[model samples]
Target: MTTQANVDTRISEPDAAQISEFLRDHPDFFDTHQDLLAELRLPHSSGKAVSLIERQVQVLREQNETLKSRLLELVNVARENDRLSGRMHQMTLDLLAASSLVGMLDALEDHLRNEFKADVIALHLPGLSETQLHESGAENLVVNETLKELLPTPLCEGKPQCGRLKQQQLDFLFKDQAAAIESTAVIPIGHHGQGGLLAIGSREVNRFNPCMGTLFLSHLGELLSRMLQKHTAG
Candidate 1:
């Protein structure tokens, strides 16, 4: 009842699976019939017919390349972390060495510009009184009694915030540079912002984003908080 066409159709690909299973079950079969290795011709991307052994080697080479790339990426990241760590240490020394509020601000601005690559820096110490500001020689220090009210919800609760901010918030922090800034980071200095707050602006849109880790920012805030309290206290 089966013609040549039907016979050919009946010979499905399942027989190949059976053959593969048989080969796997009897590894010695390949030892007995070493001639099969020469019959396996795999087409490569370069349009060349390669032997089965060569194909396996090529695949392994590709996997090795992928692993190497990943390892290189991790090494680069580690190097960057080390660089950031060194910069942070220098900043700590600068802040500690500051004799007055003006000196502290100067240290902060210099490090931010040279080490952190920040486009604009805004330090807000709304807790300080006008007399304190005058005495500390911080006439240019940004102060806002209602700064907490103007912040985003998370920042209001003393969270580190990053990414694109609303125009009003940008204007509040960076004033002249607000329009030029494409991204910003808002780091809370202390509880209720009694110490102060820091706003770091960048011209690049992706420079500051919500997904970035806040560990460094948190450390920066804590260090600044101690210095601010020391310098601003009566």
Candidate 2:
């Protein structure tokens, strides 16, 4: 039989050993629990937060795309503007070139050839009043073969040739030669009282139409007239 004291001791002794072991492990276990609790309790972003960030990114992307499209439109407009500006600049140069005396005829000829592409150009000065073609003693006046033939007989008869020749008169004189001369622009090359005529010819029938703007030619004509007046008086 076991003694009572020994039985009690066995039960109490096991209980005391268990208490000591639990005390020894308590600090380490508490530290582990604290780390786990910290992990669980720490701030955790949900799917909603990620979704919000993605939405913001998408909005920014759309804004960037819109900006790029606007930028491209501006670039295209700028290029077109530049092209138009260049054309205008060239036209201005052509106009300026046609406003001088020597340069006027040269520019007019070039413009007609390069711009309007005319075939022939003739400048004519009718005799002044009291100045007979035969008696005026004006030689070395540039005349083509056709004009020489037309003016010779009437001029020998001592007819007065002052005053502007009517358009009808020009039409009558050149009517038969229409087949060879497709188009004609008879521009008066001076102020009303003292100017001569510039006859521009083109092989193309539609080159010198009535509807064409005469502003440039008119200014050039005035310059030519001034030059002629100076030369005649000198």
Identify the candidate with maximal TM-score: 1
Q: Candidate 2's error at 185, in angstroms?
A: 1.1
The local distance difference test score of each candidate is 0.81, 0.52
In the range 1-234, model 1's lDDT, one tens digit per residue, is 779998787776468779899878997986877797889899989999999889989999999999999999999989989999999999999999999877888898899988999998887666667776665433243434465567843346778889999999898778877999999998877764446678899999999999987888889998988998788778
Pairs that clash in candidate 2: 112-117
Candidate 1 residue runs with Cα over 4 Å from true position:
1-35, 133-150, 153-158, 191-194
Report the number of the highest-lDDT candidate: 1
lDDT of 2 by residue, 167-190 (tens): 454454344443456666655555
Q: Which residue pairs show collisions in model 1?
A: none
Clashes of each: 0, 1
* Model 2 weakest lDDT span, ten residues long: 154-163
TM-scores vs. true structure, each candidate:
0.74, 0.36
Cand. 1 TM to true fold: 0.74
Evaluate residue 44 in candidate 2 and report its C-alpha lDDT on the 0 to 100 scale: 20
